[model samples]
Target: MTKAWAEEILDWNYEPPYDFYNDNNKEESMKELLEAPYFAVLNDSGNLAGFYCIGYAAQVPLGYLFGAYQEDCVDIGLGMKPELTGKGNGGSFIRFVLEQVKGSKSIRLTVADFNERAITLYERAGFKKTYMFAGEEMSFFVMEKRSL
Candidate 1:
């Protein structure tokens, strides 16, 4: 990922009623991008559209409670440009990422239960809820999708 994209993801945040993204120090965030399975989503023009990470662990605080460490089911963490949210582009962006990782047997993602919009997008993409739990300051759902 480019330095600009990394900075964008590092600084991602959401509005009230759905304050999901966390603010991490630059050093830690940059280290994650450099070491994790994170990948940048690009627009047709090759600019960053968003970013997603595929792994058996999550970036969320207390994410382990959501089973983010299971090897059998890969986990995904993602974000779109803060300015691009609520614009009806989420589903397509997720689909685009899924297409890139379609070879996996199963995939999972944890969404803050209050992030109803994200939950809807995941449900529409065929992810079924595996469980729910409370963590830090909010509730979360662990959802998964399987490939045949």
Candidate 2:
């Protein structure tokens, strides 16, 4: 992602309806986004739609979910622009991202329990809840999608 797009993404905020990631501390958020190895998700016109990181869950504290860093599976972290969410395009967008990943028989992602919309999107894309993990601030479901 370009520095400009990364800055824009770090500034994206959610309203009360989507408060799952509601953090008032922008500095920490920006740092985390910038430090993560993520790729820009661009729209058809090539504008940044969002950003995602492949296999990040295995490296973060969330590694507990994989029983000390399993390498046989792929785990993803995704963030869509706050404005683009709930506009009826998430399912297709996720599918397209999945298509871009290479050489993995299965993919996994973790989502906060409060993110019903994201859970629904993952479910529709054939992801099933494998287990749940409790983080310091919230609980999450580790969902998995196996290639058919």
Query: Relative to the true structure, how large is the alpha-carbon lDDT of every model?
Result: 0.78, 0.76
Candidate 2 lDDT (Cα, whole model)? 0.76
TM-score of each: 0.86, 0.83
Candidate 1, residue 26: the lDDT equals 79
RMSD of each: 2.1, 2.7
Candidate 2 error regions (>4 Å)? 22-35, 57-71
How far in Å is the alpha carbon of 65 misplaced in model 2? Answer: 7.3
The clash count of every prediction, one per candidate, is 0, 0
lDDT string for model 1 (1-148, tens) is: 6677788777777677655476647798788786777888889998787888877435455766665445477678888887788999998999998887787478888888888888999999999887777865788888889777
Tell me which residue pairs clash in candidate 2. Answer: none
Task: Summing lDDT over every window of 10 consecutive residues in candidate 2, give the lowest-scoring window.
Answer: 57-66
